[model samples]
Target: MELVIGIDIGGTKTKIGLVDKEGKCLEDTFFRTKEYPDIDDYLDKVVATIEELKDKFNYANILGCGIGAPNASSKNGTIENASNLLWKGTVPIIKKLNERMPMPMRIMNDASVAALGEMLFGNAKGMSDFIVITLGTGFGSGIVANGKLIDGFDGFAGELGHIDMTLGDGRITGLGVKGGLEAYVSATGLKRTIMYMQSKYLDESRFRSIAYNDLHGEDITKAAEEGDPIALKAFDYTAKILGLALANFTAFTQPEAFFLLGGLVNSGKWILDPLHTYFEEHLLEVYKGKVKLLSSGMEGKTAAISGAASLIWESHTDEY
Candidate 1:
């Protein structure tokens, strides 16, 4: 059967899947990324996995391959400075992968792929202009404008995480700005808030049993749902900053909606309600109620792969 391959290169592990044109994943596999010692080793292992898939399936109708990696530049097909990865500099991933597989290959940031996936087959389906925000180990934002992903002059546009939004005398520094939005809204950002709250609010019983260091965005959300005061405060803090940022973006880009993806968004109303409240509070009257913050309706990994698959499918169609 005709198929396409999609790969999501994450900080912890990598996911590979075979999918058809309609976004249905036919087969899927996951592997520990430690198989490789360096970027080159990782590429070798990836190529080897592709070869194995090809041999096992013997599928002649394979269309192309798509990859989503953090800090990836679609224009150059390189992973440039992923804060979560061990790599130090730019890695010419697409060139290396193409040399081995020799098929139509495309690469993009994981968040961008997720946004595209939603636009193509998920929550943002039928919408041409929107943004997808992935709140995980870090913050990732993707923009789709005029019906296509905006890969700026050098493929470095839509970097919403780096936007400045922090306020205070002793806030964390980002790049050069003090208290950037990322300093308050990302996984690390939220953790810092939780730590502060724990120090101020957690009593003996609460402090001794909880694992604050190991806590993730999901845990914070769950705690908030259970009426944990500390967790609710953290989400409230994050929501204020995030809502402010969204208000600012809405003024500039005027997208139809913003899709919230990743673990943090799963907190549901604990985060969303506050986010909406602040967003409305900060937004101008004209733009108020126009932009929405919605959950991603797409399958996470599958949506990314499907996005990668579109890299080839859409391009081929355009050519024909």
Candidate 2:
């Protein structure tokens, strides 16, 4: 019964869990990330938590530790330039944690970890190539090409959000392009689309009553599920762009499948229909019937933690 500590570090909270090689979590803890202002204090708390859990579980050997943080580098074991974290620069996370646990450590960006998790234990198990796109605050993707996670030369590969898409002279945001996939597919981006429609197409329409910022992807989904014209159109608009982007990716990598995850994807049919429709519509002729776009079998917080756990398994197995 070999076990490892897995941590999923988000902007607001960090989820720590003890997972066996079988992908089952034996124990878990949640803590507010803001509780500690300094990085050292943060690491200390994490170390103490692992110690407490190891002692209580009576595990003799903690095989390894794995962490999933936004913008983490798997090859370097460092977190670099995270948009949502308090850190301003590269931080050596592996070194700090190794001091406490004295075990092998692995780290990856949250999205990459999620993709890896899927490959190891979920939908992508036994598959060699696929992409996992998390539709949340932003669109994050982890790419696996040819049975291995593509780390690129600098270890910062698979930034699918920045893929360029035609915007037709829309208002520009800080992402610096006229329109990127992230501009239309992420949670924030979807809200922006809602605002655009309110001011453009829905000025005197009933949809205007819904507050722009307060409106969520789920709200739009519910309305769509009930056959609201406005919500249906919104899904169509967003899904079309996502489909096109996915088609472009398919033409290049030709992955066996594309795994969709995160809260926004919970829209179920409201999203999947249009997404699949457009993806197939725009796919290269040869890839028409080859690619599969599937919803993530794992959902919510567990998806990311599962990914972190897979990192531990991969790191341990690689040594042999």
RMSD to truth, every model: 2.6, 2.3
lDDT of 1 by residue, 1-320 (tens): 77778898887888787777667676777778766659778887787776676676784588889888888899998999776677768989889888877888888888888877777667887787899898876778889888888888988887788776534433563444566667777777887888777777754333236676776677776677677778878889889989999999888778899988876776778888999999999998999888988888877656666766666666654321
Question: How many pairs in model 2 have backbone atoms within 3 A of each other, for residues 3 or more apart or on separate chains, i.e. clashes?
Answer: 0
Q: Report the C-alpha lDDT of model 2 over 130-156, residue by residue, as the tens digit.
A: 999998888889999988888877778
Error of 1 at 159 (Å): 1.5
TM-score of model number 1: 0.90
In order, candidate lDDTs are 0.78, 0.80
When summed lDDT is taken over every stretch of 10 residues in candidate 1, the lowest stretch is 166-175
Give residue 46's error in model 1 in angstroms.
0.9
